[model samples]
Target chain A: MLRVENLSAWYGEARVLRDVALRVDAGEVVTLVGRNGAGKTTVLRCLMGLHAGQRGTVELDGRDIGRLPTHRRARLGLGWVPDDRGSYASLSVAEQLTLPPVLRPRSSAERTGLAWSLERVFEAFPVLYQRRSVPASTLSGGEQQMLALARVLRMGARLLLCDEPTEGLSPLLVTQVGDILRQAKRHGVTVLLVEQNLRFATEVADRHYLLAQGAVAEALDNSAVRSRERELLAYLGI
Target chain B: MTGFLQNTFNGLVSGAFYALLALGLAVIFGMLRVVNFAHGAFYMLGAFGAYVLLAEAGVSFWWALLLMPIGLALFGMLLERAVVHRLGRLDPLYNFLFTFGLTLILQDVVKSRYGVQSSPYATPAELSGSVDLGLFDFPTYRVFILVFAVAVCALVWWLLSHTRVGVVVRAATERPELTRAFGIDVGRWVTPVFGFGVGLAGLAGVLAAPMRAVNPLMGADLIIVVFAVVVIGGLGSIFGSVAAGFGIGLVQSWGEAYAPPIVAQTLVFIVMAAVLLLRPAGLFGREESAA
Candidate 1:
């Protein structure tokens, strides 16, 4: 489980996230739906300790990791898939996959139950396996996204934090990503997603937190999001 | 033709030194993003380290060659921890200035101590004699330098490409944030990497002590040529540094033999300018992505 309380972040003098609070329980796919500059990505960055100017408490599994460094947070089982897909240009797909040393497992069950191997990742994204020896930069946008996701999974991340994983992806690839998220949920991987695509977010996420102007505006269950789809779309200005 | 062969061979020996120095520069620049103006100073210190070990400690040249780099490497680590690491978040120019100042201080210290004269380092007895290579008789020491430089370069390349440490280093080189995100303590590698690079510079210094006049200003003279070599090869490129080091060495030698002295003196810069005009990224440098 992850909990963020009164998270306030800034870029120099410009405050970007103000008193933003959100939480995600284990085995749930939660999404932060927002417009551009709604502080969703900033939220993720703050959580990952990538935002140096952030002030708040970020608790991962009841442990305060706010003061921990980015790498330390990662070693504590937090995996990030950035909006840019953050693939090393010179590294081959196989190299990228194998580069991350698996962090120490959170629990004994995590060690045995969630042993996501390279073979499993390869099986999930067959195209990645096909282009395993090729440089990640040579891959298509969709393939790069898949490689990004696959790499984090191979690192044995328990809590996956994704930023726009479906952005710029084709509908077919988006569907494939959705299936992968569903598969991940079944395997008990907690996901906190920042998404622009409400339709895709609703499909994959069990609950959604709509963000506006650097703060959480609404929290809705999957059924509430579906019933209030038109109202939510208008609120989100979609 | 025999004269040409002899000059070419001589060029290669000098090139080996250039390659060694440039390789260190490349590695330091690749990891730390520091220009490391003190690299030349480090090289000078390496040579002096050997000289001191021999004169004061009663150590032999062979043992100095083996032990001096390790000693200098520790010195380099201390330098990083004390000075270079502090400037990590500052503008790269701060690092440049800091290193430049360190270079001056180091040069002054050495000059004050040793009186700025070229000191002769005796070649090891095993490598003192000349070897006939059919085309010409070559100093056994020069041949040892060539073989040793190549072997070191090869080992470095293998370490960067094949080893897990290398993978982490390469990843950190390309994307530090992402590398850290993979749970690697990239900061922990910085000190050692800096020391390693400095050690290489020291190793070159030790190697050069026997061949060149070991002097206070030796590194100062060679650093410029090494910089030119790094530029022509591609800044921060491992392969480019080595190839360009050797290539420029050969070119410089050939020019010395064939071209006028003044023209030969400026030939390396001319080649560097030409390479820049043709490919601004150098032979092996990748164009940086637009921010």
Candidate 2:
């Protein structure tokens, strides 16, 4: 249940996202697929209110949150999994999970047991528990990605804005991430992913928005995305 | 070896100030990502505030110790709001340059009024005498300084690890943007944290007023060493800054004991160079730039 219209973002004089529009329904897994510099990350950043220079109205569950700060957006149920896998040097693995306060569901219908306890997070990713006391910076790439995903889920985010969750991850880790996404979707979490991996995107996402040069080129269901996978890969130059 | 314990004790006494000042630096850098060249000026203000309190208002040591930090915290918060936050969006070097300019102004303002002479401040009569140690007697105030510094460090450690405020502050300090995206109002913490960091520096200055020459240049000289201490300890790590502060003090003291005066002054820098060459992240720091 997120909607954006006439969203245009810029980096100084250069227009990165020009009048782009997209939507995602509640409990659905959606992806924005595009080539490098297609403004996928900017869209996520704008939705989170981190990108300052933008003109857009981001509606979450029929509420316009376009003017809210990043933290306010987060508290409103948007869980951000950044591309770099936000990890702090001073924070231990356990501290990272517990840092973000869990968001309470505003409506009874929104509750789908997606709110996870620390124990639940540990159960889902035992490696995090094993490395609980160590500095989060010490974790490997795959582990860091898991930590980022697990951190947002632990915070009870109803909507997940994930950026390249599988980038630089191994094949096994990619599979694990896909499973986690599927599981999240099953539990009624609405995820808007920015992914380059077409196969991975098709597997985890129900709908796809293909972005080309800062605008939405096509909105395709899973079948169309699967059928046009090779052409899309060539378009993305992957 | 003949006077190892005595030297160590002396080293720790000076180390106490480095530890306190470095703690503030670490915290401020973690949050603001600014080098804060004006931190020394704040320390000078603390000592000056205490001196002025005594000279102008007949306030005693006990009151000055209690009041200087609070007053400085308010002033610090005001400064943060008025000037520092404006430079936040630009390259970090702009703030660095601004603070550097601020330092010169602060130093000159004090100099214009009080002149460049070192002002004398009497240690509280209660802590003036020497204390009996098993091996050798040490000045009561020096012992108090060491013990009090350790206690403050411990209190800060406990507060950071055990309290809810500490966790939020720590998270925001270490990773501001990410913490915000996690639903934390990180901006709310910035001013207070800066105030707290400045208050810590002021507190150290209050303590120094009785022990060292109360002069504008005092902080300037001490801050150079403290900067080395911060680097050696790692940039934003609280524990690293404190530990490196004390460790560098010991190195400098031992150098003074066995080597020449110039060597003693440069010893901390030498150690810093070695630490940098070996561990670029400092002893306890993470490799990534904080946030």
What is the lDDT of every predicted structure here? 0.90, 0.91
CAPRI band for model 2 = medium
Q: Model 1 clash pairs?
A: none
Local accuracy of candidate 2 as per-residue lDDT tens digits, A1-238: 8999999999999999988899999999999999999999999999999987899778998999999989998988999999889987677889889888887778797664467899989999999999999998799999999999999999988899999999999999999999999998888889999999999998999999999999999999989988887888899999
Taking the tens digit of each residue's C-alpha lDDT, what string does model 2 give over B1-291?
A: 439989999899889999999999998898888888989999999999999999999999889988999998998899899889988989988899999999999999999999999999999999999988988889999999999999999999999987877888788877788889998888788898889889999999999999999998888999999999999999989999999989988888889999888878788888889999999999988787533
Kindly give the number of clashing pairs for every candidate.
Answer: 0, 2
Residue A99 displacement (Å), model 1:
1.7
Question: Which runs in model 1 stand beyond 4 Å of their true positions?
Answer: A109-113, A227-238
Q: Which ten residues in a row have the lowest lDDT in candidate 1 chain B?
A: B282-291
Top candidate, metric TM-score: 1
Clashes of 2: 2
Q: Residue-wise lDDT of candidate 1 within B131-225, one digit each (tens)?
A: 99998899999999999999999999999888888888888887888788888899999899999999999999999888888889999999999
lDDT for position B222 in model 2: 91
